[model samples]
Target: MKKIIVLFSLALLSFSAQAQEIKWMSFSEAIAAQKKVAKPIFMDVYTDWCGPCKMLDRNTFSDPGVVSHINQNYYAVKFNAEGTEEINFNGKKFTNPNFDPNRKGRNAMHEFTGFLRVPGYPSMIVIDEKGSVKKTMVGYKTPEQLRADI
Candidate 1:
């Protein structure tokens, strides 16, 4: 019993120590909060069917330094490139007509994607403090590279 308790405690501590955490925030919340805090938006645009997207999420996005920097410098938003939700941004509404709400692993494309033109998997879109787009990064990037982007 003593050994089991010790092992469980050690497991908890190890899980808690993993640092890379991209924030989980809604688009509306990020935009509204950005109005108050004036921070950029760091969005992870991914697809459920994309393997590389999941890889980046599990690796780079899980780094402690990357999580800290993103949370501090930007309002982290996770957007599905093929999600079914209707996203209204800057007076425009974006949705997927072919999107099946009942479908698994597929949805609608964000209208913002059309404007941003990020037709790639695992893209990172950065919006400046004033709500203007600063840059868009695509594909899997190392934690070091991701830090530089911020």
Candidate 2:
């Protein structure tokens, strides 16, 4: 009986490990991955304090179907809309020029977000392999909705 229980636990662990998961990476990492395999880029542009962004992460991104689809079809990127990190893309450097180091709540938007014309939080940007913007989806989206959009 103990051996059977151990075997069952091992099987459960292996199954969990094989479960589909979104490979969320930084913008630069996604770009590098695109160069290697030439897959489309799917970027999730969100803020740390945005409620909808958290919901999207929990509901849509965590869904097995969404995870499998994104992992298979695109290089997933997670970009903080109000972050201070510098991003170099298309021969230009982008940064959050007005980002405050002290203030808490909402912060200045990143330059790359503005460059991509993201008007609000929880924006989803899809880029072609050639580095051109293919589509920009705004607001919260369900797993089914995002799958259809993709």
Candidate 3:
């Protein structure tokens, strides 16, 4: 019983120590934070039904090194490509005009997604503090690859 308790305690401590979470903010919040801190914006454009996007979340984003680097260097934003939420970006309002609430699998893409010109799922957009796009990376990238790209 004592041995089991010690092992359980060790497991708890290990889990806590490895819990390095990235501070993912909304698009508006990321923009707001950029204005204050002058850091570049890193936006993760994903759809709820995208498999690669889910993989990115489960793999690359979950890596501690990637989380630490992103948190320190950029204002991270998670934007749902097919979301219905209205967003005000660069003095313009964007929304998903064709969104169907009852639709399953795939839905209408958000206006902001079009504005960013995201070609596919699991896209990563990097914008400078001046609100200009710096880079647009498509598809899935490992933590090391993401760090190298950024």
- Candidate 3 per-residue lDDT over residues 17-104, each given as its tens digit: 6897889999889888877889998999999999999999999999988998999999998999999778998899999999999999
User: For model 3, what is the error of residue 120's alpha carbon versus the real structure, in angstroms, after optimal superposition?
Assistant: 1.0
Question: Residue pairs in steric clash, candidate 3?
Answer: none
lDDT of 2 by residue, 1-150 (tens): 999999999999988865657998988998888788899999999999999999999899988889989999999999998998889999999999999989899999899988999988899999999999999999999999999999
Candidate 1: tens digits of C-alpha lDDT, residues 40-97: 8888888999998988888888888888888887889998887766677778777767
**How big is the positional error of residue 80 in model 3, measured in Å on the Cα after superposition?**
0.5
Query: Best to worst by lDDT, what's the order?
Result: 2, 3, 1
Task: Quote the lDDT for 108 in model 1.
Answer: 62
lDDT against the true structure, each candidate:
0.81, 0.92, 0.92
Question: Can you give the lDDT of residue 1 in candidate 3?
Answer: 100
Q: Model 3 scores what on Cα lDDT?
A: 0.92
Select the stronger candidate by lDDT from 1 and 2: 2
TM-score for each model: 0.82, 0.90, 0.90
